[model samples]
Target: MAPTVLRLLLMLLALLPTIGLGNNAAIADTDSTPAELTIANRSIFTFHATFLGETPAARAQRATAVIEEALRGTDELKVSIDPLQNSYLVLLGNRRAFIVSPQDLEVSGGDTRVAAEQAAAVLRQVVDESGEARNLHFLLKAFGLSALATLIFLVLIKGAHLARRKLRGRLPQLMRERARQIRVGQMPLFDMQFVYRIIDRLLSLFYWVVVLLLGYQWLSFVLSQFPYTRPWGESLNVHLLDLLRYLLDGILQAIPGIAVAILIFFIARGISGFSRRVLERMARPGTLNWLTEETLQPTVRLTSLAIWLFALVMAYPYLPGSGTDAFKGLSVLLGLMISLGASSMVGQAAAGLILTYSRTLKTGEYVRVGDNEGTVTEVGMFNTTIRTGLGEVLTLPNSMITGSVTRNYSRAVQGRGYIVDTVVTIGYDTPWRQVEAMLVAAAQRTEGILDTPKPQVFQTGLSDFYPEYRLVAQAVPSEPRPRAELLSLLHANIQDVFNEYGVQIMSPHYLGDPAQEKWVPQDKWYTAPAKGQSADEP
Candidate 1:
């Protein structure tokens, strides 16, 4: 047993030289040739030898001797017996030459001079059988190892795919159950459905990535044993990993901005809802109108704007161009543009603010500006709109309104009565006392005139043709449309009263001469009472 082991070890040692020689010869051939060389002039040489030898090495030695014998008459196939060459040469069919190195054979271009001679020698030595046996063994071993590796890779990929499918199938049902529970009780931290979907998608992505990575590693391992694909596989691995790294970086960068945007949207919605409720409550009957007008809407708008601005600032780093020089330059340019164009807008806004705080006129208030009298319908930052009784709407800039004189009739008297006055003309023949009584009675007879304040009559002017009397009446505060009606009624009543008193109203006549006497009704009716009666008997 000891001798058998020692002999086996010696045989392995003896084969080491042939392996070394084959490796060196392969390297030398590859180094000596360019990579672009085609297989155009290739040749194959087979050798079969009937060796009457006792050992395998001796048989191989006899095969080498047969190959050398075939090369003797061939000029192109030179058989060098040098120990360093560790090979023999032969000519093949006169088309090519072969160098049978220690463990491999090389073929090259040669002339067709020694073809018949080499063929005869090969036939005599019988070289084909030994070479065919060696080639068949090598090809069968390579094919078996390749088939085993492919089978293992396919089984691994198939198992991983099956596992992934099973997990994916179970995920949806579990997520549905969890979502139902959350909906029935309270809201979860993240929306249950959304979170579950995100998790499932991430898991799916991870599973595919792991599968792909494992496949790639296995392929790289298998390819490393190959002579052609080893270098290319390493480069592909680096590019694949770089792509995955860039994808991860992009996802990470987007997460914070997406979160911030969602948060801001929800928060703004909540705040807007709260503010609306508060405004509705405040706008209810009997609440302070000033609070609704001055505080609620502007506060809500400003708060919403501020929240969005803050969110934008917080998300700036995650914005695509926020950190770039172009963004900074654009910011500056936009600011300059706004400054150039916003001066009038700023002025109008300031004026509007002043108008709101001043409370000079509100919507639905009757106002008169110069000759324009109307009801205010809208008040904007830049303009105030009014609808006139004549059915015309007028838009006035805030700046124009601020510098003009405006009379607000609604604010003149809160709950007090409004005064409506009318004027009349009568001859001097009418007694001043009687005129005063007649004017007061006329105002009292008019509809919508307040009797408590008592209509007043003042002698406004005493012209040469007539004496002008002003009749003023008070109206109820709630009666807005009664002023013109009351005035018309009073003038009609005055005409009737003056006619009853026989007082001539001198409206059309101007005094042409003082000598033309205006008639006195009392002078015409002057007759002395009958004598011999009691003195007070008129």
Candidate 2:
């Protein structure tokens, strides 16, 4: 045997119950700190105190050598103990094996001689077993028993495979017959193949776990049949039981805490449902004007999220493993990750909430922000989607919207319509009254332009050359395509009116006076492309 194995064996024996003689093995040791004397890997007795300054372990080692030599001889082993001053001598046949001091004896009234006799009795029993283990008949019987156990183990392993095959054959059909589609409404969450793979993996894992347990039992049983390996076999059984008990107890102890945490979450869910219904009722038109069907959605989600988060805090102590360092570390890691990454996301969400609650923006309203002008298609928490009449879609971040100048054209209108305005810089020669009247006439002639409020013209700026005239009008038909069409018709009418009135609409950006005038006559108004071909594709 390896020296490491021998040392481990000796250390392991120290942890086991000390062997006295017969019933005395159970006797409580008060004064003795004994060292074990093992034969054939089986512990027979113990020695206490050093003989001639030798330690208890050294004396036990010497005694074990003496006992082993006696067993090697042809004569049967004879054990006896002789009393002496302050100690007793354990004798193997006529040879002195070792001495036992008061340290090896129980504190009871029994003398050292009586203790030595008990020790002799236990040694006799152990020596007889060791001798029998070496006998041919005994060895043959042990080999047969081991062979029988091996055969049973092999048969069982084969049977397990057969059972596994039988299970595999029927399991798929059984699972299919009992399977229910996991879906939300008409949509299947996943395909059947995904479920099958998961089942197959679980089945294979269970099969291997059972096979390993069976192998452990078989090996332990085979080891237990021989005297030399019996301690190993017994240790396996004891440790396995201990491990299982620990796991079972831990699970049992954790159940109540887990149940409490689960119960808290269920209660929170109930509260959430109730709060949602209450919030929905509170979001009616008269209840909270800002919380419309569209705007109320964010509030509902936030309320639910807040409730769940609060519930988590309340139930954290009751959660299994919550007190463990690993769970605390995981929570801190998640918090750090969120704090590091969510700066922009949080700003966007806050802006969205402000936009919704303050009624600053609404879906389907025409708005111009920065250089992008379109109808708001969706006002989401992080981004707003706008679809332009020019066939371009814009996804603007909420934070960007909050930071830039915004012009809402549809908010002040009574119905589904948007404001339309066009700027014209006519020469100083054209009268401001004529310019305003002509612009109003153009707007009145255009289709879809609302007339109830009447269009207005503003001389917004008086530049060095001419005045900048802006014609502002309201147009019905909130749809984006109609707005573009109405603006086109208005521009066409303005050109026709200016031509019919014999007034040349000239840009006032010239550095010098023109020779005559920069005017496109009525004949060329519908230039080759304006009538059919693309005038200028955007």
Each prediction's Cα lDDT score?
0.60, 0.79
Top TM-score model: 2
**Residue range 392-424, candidate 2, lDDT tens digits:** 899999989999999999988768888999988
- Alpha-carbon TM-score of each model against the true structure: 0.39, 0.68
N/CA/C clash count, model 2? 1
lDDT of 1 by residue, 91-202 (tens): 3333113333333222343322243244335433333322332466745664576677778878887887788889878887887787766663466545766786798788
Residue 335 deviation, candidate 1, in Å? 2.2
Model 1: residues with Cα > 4 Å off, grouped in runs: 1-252, 268-320, 324-333, 414-538
Model 2 stretches with alpha carbons more than 4 Å out: 1-194, 225-233, 289-291, 338-349, 371-397, 420-422, 431-457, 471-508, 519-538
C-alpha RMSD of each candidate structure in angstroms: 20.8, 9.1
Candidate 2 minimal-lDDT segment of 10 residues:
20-29
